[model samples]
Target: MFDSLNGNQLKKESVMLKKASIALMIVFLMVSVCSARVVDGVDMPETLQVGDAILVLNGVGTRTIAFVIKPYVGGLYLKNAETDAKKIMMADETMAIRLNIISSTGRGTMMNALRKGLRSSLDAMGGDFEMIRTRFDAFQEFFPEDKFEEGNFVDFAYLPGEGLKVYKNDGFVGLIEGIDFKQAFFGIWLNEPSPADSDLKTAMIAGDVSGEARAAQGQWLAKVDLEQEKKAAEAEAAALAKAAAEARAKEEAEQKRLAEEKAKAEAEAKKLAAAKPAPAKPVPAAAPAKAAAPAAATAVATMPAAANNALVAAFLVNAIKTSEQIAVQQGKPFDADAETRRILDMWSKIKAEVAK
Candidate 1:
């Protein structure tokens, strides 16, 4: 191809190619510097005009679920580029947040997400609960449609003095008046607790729309924290169980000690009783009073020694019966019945010997 061109023709062709190359470079630079960011296949403009205020795109992020479901692409537009989320939320200047619904999101689902975010935002702001609730209730009416399908645009533009204006698919929804509401509403994404997705929050703050926020590892640390909490709970439970077991063991040991003390006391009592001397048996009482005193004396004088012994034994038996009654009333630990039987047997033997 070069051989077909003459020397002059080659020079002209070379100049044309250089000019074309420079123009292409200029075009590329312009496009790079002023191009719209594409996030999750949604085009986010570099600048947004809201109520005569021009806001620049600070960043773009995609709201994802488990790193798989991409619901919407959120673009943050501010008066100036900012990396700090707190500053952005606190600033009262004109700013706008654009949400391009890339998937089917129902009105209920969107409102629920907003409610969670706003709650966190309001809590962070520490504003009046009733006032914030009132504003939030009014804000709920902004999303009157049942569902915001794919290719829908939801824009929340905050004007410093006028409050926050909402638009659904470029159609005006409603306005909620209050800087307090704005602080809480934006805090859903910029707040520390993260009402929606933390990874998306980071991306929006960083001004990058690389889809890295949707990565699986984005929530890895959260999972790690949960696992750590679970382990701590299990450890606490195990410690409680061990404490209970130890208490039971201690109780059982004390009970065993008490039982041993009781048995030892009983044994000592038995030993003391065994070592003590036995009491003498009682003598029998005299015969019945039906006999006269002189006759009793004569009978005693004429009676054999065995008969006298029987008479004493009878008296002893009568004494023992009275003592048994006293012992019963006093709750004494004495065998009164056995002692009576022994005395009776002795008397009978004495009587029988006397007759023989």
Candidate 2:
């Protein structure tokens, strides 16, 4: 009976240890699964407890909103709709939501409507602005009287009730009510002459000739004065012609003087030739006995072997000196003795061949 009691106590202790090991394994598995999962917007692991706050991603396209959780709300609330509801119940979660994008077509329609409303408002103002009136006056002043029709000036004068319309680039600017020729002249600083008023047209045409047109006519007269300049040019040309005649006369005189001098030189040359003495013909004569005697004495004096060699040496030396003198005159240097010997050898060989 005591052994049976001890065995039952050992079995109960073994079962308790097994239960503890299973509980530890289940805790480790839970931890491992929580650590492996990533919470993107929350920036925390799924291991977050029920009280831990975290962020979450929301919105579309490139935009995102981060929502923070309170102690009651956690990253686990994003797991499902039921958890989301629990998060809403537990904490106040505000989201930065974006409105829809506005398209170009919608913007264009709005801009057109704004422009139309602005134009209507401006028109309702009756153009009382001083700047607008001044601009209109400037535009009306731009159109001159010559631009109007032939009988329009008369019509404008007769119909004083009619308004004068002003335009800029063919766009309506404003109107000038009740204007006369004098008022128009005051505005534009020019008189509008009517065709029906012949006296005014004649006076205007004549006055134009007296005013700015007179200055233009004066310029024309100045141009006509250029014709008178031709007389001065002709006078200058005539003076040149007289000077040329004098120059021609002077040149002829110089030519005549040169001809006279040349003729005189030729006459003097002819006179000198006629007066010169004739050259006498040279006649061959026999050499004197004294000259022959001296040549014989020279030959006899050079007859000895040493004397002949000395004579030949002296002759060669003289020949070399002459050749060196010629070389010096030609801007060159020559070896006197060597050149003389070379020339003597060449002469000797030529003489020997001739003799053979």
Candidate 3:
């Protein structure tokens, strides 16, 4: 039905449709990007200037209610990627943390978590909680505006000589003075004890650096220790190999002795049989002389039994001699009672092979 349309008309329509679609995609991506700071949902700037010092986004994380309810988007900002939390805490360089409030409940809950994190950090630093009690009491003055509501952004900016600068929605709030305060407050999110905020710390350390670069910085000591462990393992393996070789040699000697004993027993049995005088008897007229055959059959039947006894005797002697040494290879004391029956069974198989 549309074949009647001009070629130019069709081309123009197609171009308009493509442009509209592209426009819509751009709008969606913009909305998504804004909602998610840095990425989507983490509202953070690549470089946020604090006083005279310009800082880069270290990482972005979300603080949730019961791990599901969205509360606030937290961001850690530093000069660059820093895997070590201690360096962040000790570094007098400018760094900032932002908590972008997403919900009304973020005020009380998120703040409480922050306070608890700071206290835990303080405890880790070995400071008396009461000594810093007043610092926190005075620190509560920043929240006086009752507008700790949604869409509010709070920043904790640290300057070397001036201490921490608190800001709300871009307006200057107040200052929490002292180097000790910075260590404890930063530690809350940067160190342990804040399981909920650990993700934020991780994101900050990761920054935009490659994984290999971060691992190199993080695992230098561990790599040194790993080399030591490898050397120790090699030495232990060489010792075990030496012990196993000695065991095999001892086992070979025992087997040779057993074979010699079996030969000796067989020879001695045959000699004794030959030395014994045969009793003479008159043969019956009807019966064929089978006396020589009976004697030969008797010797053959007894040969297997004698060989079996010799093998069993040799195995037992070896077991007794090597039990303690075998235990050393096992890295424990040898249990003679448990192994005796097993050795006997093995001896029986060897004897059976000889009989066959």
lDDT by residue (247-307, candidate 1, tens digit) is 6788789999999999999999999999999998998997776622322233334334544
Backbone steric clashes in candidate 1, count: 9
Instruction: Name the TM-score of candidate 2.
Output: 0.20
Instruction: Look at candidate 1 and tell me the lDDT of residue 241.
Output: 53
In order, candidate lDDTs are: 0.72, 0.36, 0.65
* Candidate 1 vs candidate 3, TM-score winner: 1
The clash count of every prediction, one per candidate, is 9, 0, 6
Candidates 1 and 3 compared: the better one by lDDT is 1
- Every model: Cα RMSD to truth: 29.5, 46.7, 37.1
Consecutive 10-residue window with the lowest summed lDDT within model 3: 291-300
- Return the TM-score for each candidate structure: 0.48, 0.20, 0.46
Candidate 2: tens digits of C-alpha lDDT, residues 1-356: 43455455545545554554555454444333222222222222222111121112111111111333111101111111221211222222221111111111233342333233323323333322232444344544544433332111110111224444433323444444533321322211112222212232222122111122233333333433433443444455455556656667887899999999999999999999999999988887977644222222233333323426677667655656666766676667677666755656654655566679
Using lDDT as the yardstick, the better of models 1 and 2 is 1
> Residue 7, candidate 2: how far off, in angstroms?
99
The worst-scoring run of ten residues by lDDT in candidate 2 lies at 150-159
Model 1 segments beyond 4 Å from truth? 1-34, 207-356
Report lDDT (Cα) of residue 7, candidate 3: 38
Which pairs clash in model 1?
Answer: 283-316, 284-312, 284-313, 284-314, 284-315, 284-316, 285-314, 285-315, 285-316
